[model samples]
Target: MARNFIRETLAKENETFLRRMEIPNKDSWSPENGPTSVRRHPFCSSLKMFLVALSFAYFSKALSGSYMKSTITQLERRFDIPSYLIGVIDGSFEIGNLLVIAFVSYFGAKLHRPKIIALGCLLMSLGTFLIALPHFIIGRYKFETSVRSSANSTNNLTLCPTSVLVGNHSSTLSSTGCENESRLSMWIYVLLGNILRGIGETPVQPLGISYIDDHALEDNAAFYIGCVQTISVIGPVFGYLLGSLCAKIYVDIGFVNMESISITPGDARWVGAWWLGYLIAGLITLISAVPFWFFPKSLPVPEGRLAKCSPERTSFIKDSPGLDHKYQADEQFSFVRLAKEFLPTLRSLLGNPVYVLYLCVTVIQFNSLIGMVTYKPKYIEQHYGQSASKANFLMGVINIPAVALGMFSGGVLMKKLKLSIMGAAKFALGTSLLGYFLSLFFFAMGCENAKVAGITVSYEGMESLSHQNSTLFVKCNAHCECSKTEWDPVCGENGLTYVSPCLAGCRMSRGSGVDTVFEQCNCVAGGNLTAYVGHCRHRESCQRVFPYFLALCVITSFIISLGGTPGYMLLIRCIRPQLKSLALGFHTLTTRTLAGIPAPIYFGAIIDTACLKWGHKKCGGKGACRIYNTTAYRIAYLGLTLGLRTASFFLCALGLVVLQRHIKRQENGTLSNGNTGHTVAELQALRKEETHNSHSDQSPRTSDYDPERETRL
Candidate 1:
C-alpha cells in the first residue's frame, strides 16, 4: 500500500509539471482560466500587436522630446534667461535618466516588462504635464521692449525724443516695471518637468527594443526595430510642425488683445505658445500606456519563422551555472540573489572589448548629434536669417521625413543583403564617413551677420564696431536720451538694424502694434529718415544660399540615418543575449550622463560668446541674446559638430579592428569544434528539429525549444 502511494505521488507530480509547461491551444484558451488567460488572448499574444504598441510609445516619447528641442529659443526669451541657462534646462532630462536607468534596465527586465513600461509611460505623462505648468501658473508673458506704453498714448509721441524735447527720454520710458516683481525663475519648473520626462523615457527605449529583440524571429528583429525607429522619427515631424504652429501664435493669445502687442513672431522678444504642445504630447503618452498593460511579458516567435542565431552572435562568456533561476516565476525571485549577481554581470558586460569601444564611439557621436540637433533650429534662425516658425517648419516638413525613410531603408537592406555582423559594422562605418563629408559643406553656407548699428557696424556703416568698449551711444544718437537697456529693434532703409527706435534718434511713430513705423529718425543715414518695426531682411544672396543649404541638409540627414539600424544591431549582437537589457541600459546611462547632459550646456556656453546684442531683464541682469555674430556662431556650432564626428570616426576605425580580431577568434573556435563528428551530428540534429518545427502543423511552442536553441547556437 505504501509503494502504491509513492507511485501515485510521483505520477501526480509529473502531471503537474506537464500542466505548468503546456502552451494552450487557441480553442482551449478562455477568459475564465485565471491570469494566464490574458496572455493567451489572441491580440495580446501577437508579436505584431506588440510592435504596433511599441511603435506608438516610441512616437509619443519622441514627439515630446523633439518638441522641447524645437522651443529652445522661445524658452530662452520667455524666461528672460541666457542661452546657457536654457541649456541647463535642456540637460535636466538626461539627469533624470541617470537616476533610474541602471536599475530599470537590469532588474525591471526580469519582472513584468510590459507593466513596468506602463508605469514608466504614466510617469512620462505626468512630467510632460508638469513642463506645461509654468505657462499657466506664471502671469502672461511680457516681452522686454522700449515701447511698453500704448502707441496711441501721447507718451509714445517721442520714441527717440532728446532731453531738450521731452525733459528726459527716461521720463517717457514706461514705468509699469517688470511683472515678475519677485524675480522668480519660472524656468525651474520646466527643468524639473524635463528631468521627470527623462526618468520616464529611460525604460521605453532599452526595455522596448530588448523585448522586441528577445521575442521576434532573429532574421526579422532588425526590421522590427527599424519600423519602430522609422515611426518614431515621424513623431518628430509632427513635433516640429506643432512647434512651428505654436511659434506663429502669440504666447498670450487668448488672454491679451492682439492690437496691443508690438512684437511680431520674427522679433527676438517673441514667445510662442510653446506650452500647448506638451499638453497634447502628454495625452498621447498616457494613451500609449494603456495598450502595454494588456500585453504579455513575452510572446511566441512568429509562425513558420525558424530561429536563426549566427555563431558569432553567441555570448563570448559562458552562462553562469544556474543563471536561469533568475528568469523563473516572479514569486521565486530573491533580492539577495539578484544583488550578488549584479556586479558580476556588470563586470562581464564591461569586460567585452567590442562593447567598450562601441560605447566610446556612440558617446562621442551622440555628443555631436545632440548638440547639433538641440541648436539646429536656433542656428537656422540666427545664421540663415529664418524666423523661428520657418526654421521649425523646414525641419518638420523636410528633414525628418528623409530621416524616417533612410531608417526604414537601412532595415530593408540589412534583411535583403543578409549582412553578417562584420558586414553591418562596415556598412555603418561607410555611411557615417560619407555623411561626415557631406556635413562639411555647411561651413560655407552661413549668411552675413545682421548689420546692427553700433553693434556689428558703426552708425555710419563704414566699418565694424571695435570689439573693446563698444557702445550704442554713437555720435548720431548722442542727442537722444535712449536708455541703452531696451532691445526693441528697428530696421532702417539703408539695410541696418537699430537697437531700438529710441536709440535710432527717432522723434515720431505712426500706427500701433507691429504696423507702427518710426518716422523722422535722426540716426538713419539716407534722406529717407524712416525705420520699419523689425530686423532687416537678409540680402538676396543669403536667401538663395538658404535653399541650397536645406537641400544639402536633407541629403546628409538621410545618409547619416542609413547607418542607425546597423549600428544598433551591432550594439546588441556583440554582447551575450542575457546581457542585452543591462548593456542597453548601461549604454543609455553612459551616453546620457556623459554626452546628453553636458553637450547642450557646454555648447550653449560656447555659443553665448558669439552674442552681438544681449537683451535686459527688468530685474537687472543679462537676458536672452537678440542677435549673434553669424561668423562666430557658425564657426563655433559647425566646428564642434564636425570635430566630434571626426573624433568618433577615429574611434570607429579602432573598434572595427578589435571587432575583426574577435570575429576571427570566434570563427577559429567554431572551425575547431566542427571537426568533431559528435559536435557536427548534434548541430545537424538541432537544425533538423528547427526545420521540422517550423514546417510541421503540430510543432511545439517557441518556449519549448529555448534551451536546445541556445545549445545549437
Candidate 2:
C-alpha cells in the first residue's frame, strides 16, 4: 500500500513535470509528429536492417582478422621470416588503429556514421587485397632443400660426398642478399596492408554499436549486440576453415607443376595457398560495405522510449566535477570548439573509477587473449605434431562455434534475467574466473618433445641431448659431411628425425617427391636401416592427448565467451550516453596500444627461445623455427596466458567494488536531490509509453535498472 501510494504520487508529479517541460505527451506524439516525425525509407530506417548491416560488417572484419592469424605460419615460411618478425606484421594492424581511432571515435559520431563505416569497409577490402599482392608480384616460391633429385637422373641417388663442397662464397653471398631483399619486400607489403586494415576497422565497432544502442529498444540492445557478435564469430570459423582448405594446396599451385613438388602439406618447409583466402575474404568485405551506404546517419528512437537524457539537459555534464562543457543538438558545428572540449570530455570519462578499473581489467586480459589466439594454431602444429591444415580445421569446426554459442547465450541470459550493471559485472567475473581455472589444465596437456638426433634425444637413443653440447656430428655419420643448417628431415626406422637424409648417413635413395626412401642409413643403431621422407610421426601417447586438448579448448572457449556480451554491456552502461562513442574509441585505443601491439611481438619472441630447430633461409641466417622444445613452449604459452588472466581478476574484483560504491552514491544522490519525483516521473512516462506499445514488442521490466539515470554520477 505504501509503495503504491508513492508510485501514484510520483506518477502525478511526473505528469506535471512533463507538461512544465513541454515534452510531448504520449497521446500528442505519433509516427507523424515530433522526434519520430521525420519520414524515412522503411527498409533503410528499421533497426533490424541496421543490425543486419552492422553484423555483416562485424563478420567481414573478423573474417579478415582471423584469416590473418590462421596464416601466421604460412606467412613465416613464405617470407622466410622469424617469429618475431611475423609478430611485428601481426601487430601492424593495431598500429594502424592507433593512428586514427581517437579522432574517428570522437568526431565521426557527429557525422554520417553509416557512410563512414562504408568508407572503412572499402579501405579494409583494399587492405585485404594488398596483403595478397605479394603472391602475384613475387616469382615462384623456391623452397629450401638439401636433396638435388632430378627425374632424369638414375633411380638410386648418390650418398653424401665424403668432403663438404666449397662453393664460391661471393656468389652465395650475392644470392643470399637478393633472397633477403625479396623477403623484406614481401613482409613490408604485408605490414603496410595490415596497418591499412587496422585503420579501416577503427570506425566500425564504436560507431555501429553507439548507433544501435541509441536507437534500439533499451531492453533489446544487449540482445542485438550479442546477435551481431554471434554472427561475427561465424566469420572466424569460415576464415579458419578457408585457411584449412588452403593449407592443403601448394602455395604456387597454378604456376608450379604438381609432379615437381617434393614436399607434402605436412612438411615444415611447405607454404600453403594462403593468398587465395585473402582474395575471397576481400570480396566478401567489399560486398558488406554496400548496405552501410544505404543506412541513415540516425534512426528514430523506438516508439515507446524517450530520449535517454532529460529535457533540461542531461545531468552527466552538470553533475560531473570539473566537467562544464555542453553542446546542444541545434548548435552549429565547430572543429576548434569540439577540439577544445576533447580533453575535458576525456577527463570526465577517466574520472569514473568504475570505467578506469574496467579498462584495466580488459587491457590486461586482452594481452593474453590476443597472444593466445594469435599463436594457438602454431602451438597446435608444433606441440602436438599436427599439420597446419589439421590444426586449422580443428579450430574452425570446433572452437569457433563454441565461442559463437557462448556469446549468444550470454545475451539471452542477460535479457531473460534483466541483469543490471552489478549483475553483469558479477556474471562476467564468474565466467572469466571459471574459464581461467579450467585453462590451467592446458599446461598438463603438453606432448613430449619431438625426438630429433642431437636435439631432444641422442643419435643412439642411449642418452638425452642437452642444448649446451648439441651437435649433429656422431661417429656413425662423421664421414657424411652433412650441412647442420639444413632442415630437410627424414624419419629413421628407429623413430628419430634426422636433419636430412645426408645427416642420417644414407648411402642411397629411391623414388622421388614424398615417396622418396633413403636406404642403407649408417647412422641407424643397427646396420643398413632404412629411412623415409618427412619427420617421424608423433608417439601414440601424444596423438591421444591432442584430441583431449582440443576438447578442453572448446569448453574453455565457450565459457570465456559467455562473459563477452555482459562485459561489453558493462563498458557502455557505465558511461554517459552522449560520450558512448568516444568512450568506446578510447577503450579500443588503450587495448590496441597496450595489448594488441605488444602481445604478439613479445609472445613470439619468447616462443622463439624454445626453438630446437630453425629452418635455414636460402642464403643463410636464422629463419622461422621449424621445431620447438614442447615442454618449454607449453609452459611459456599457458603460463603467460593464465598469468595475465589471474592479474585481471584482481582488477575485476576491484572494479566490482568500485561499481557497487558508485551505485550506492548515485542512489543516495537521487534521494537527496528532491527530484526523486522527477526521476520516478520519467520512469512512469517511459512505462506508460511502453504499456501503449506492448503489442509491438515485449515490454521491459519496470524494475530493471536504468543506466542513463546512473550517468549523473
Q: Clashes in model 1: which pairs?
A: none
List the lowest-lDDT window of 10 residues for candidate 1: 312-321
TM-score for each model: 0.81, 0.82
Candidate 2 global lDDT = 0.80
Candidate 2 scores a C-alpha RMSD against the true structure in Å of 9.6
Cα lDDT of model 1 by residue, 173-198, tens digit: 43345443655578888999999998
TM-score of 2: 0.82
* Model 1 TM-score (2 dp): 0.81
Highest-lDDT candidate: 2
lDDT of 1: 0.79
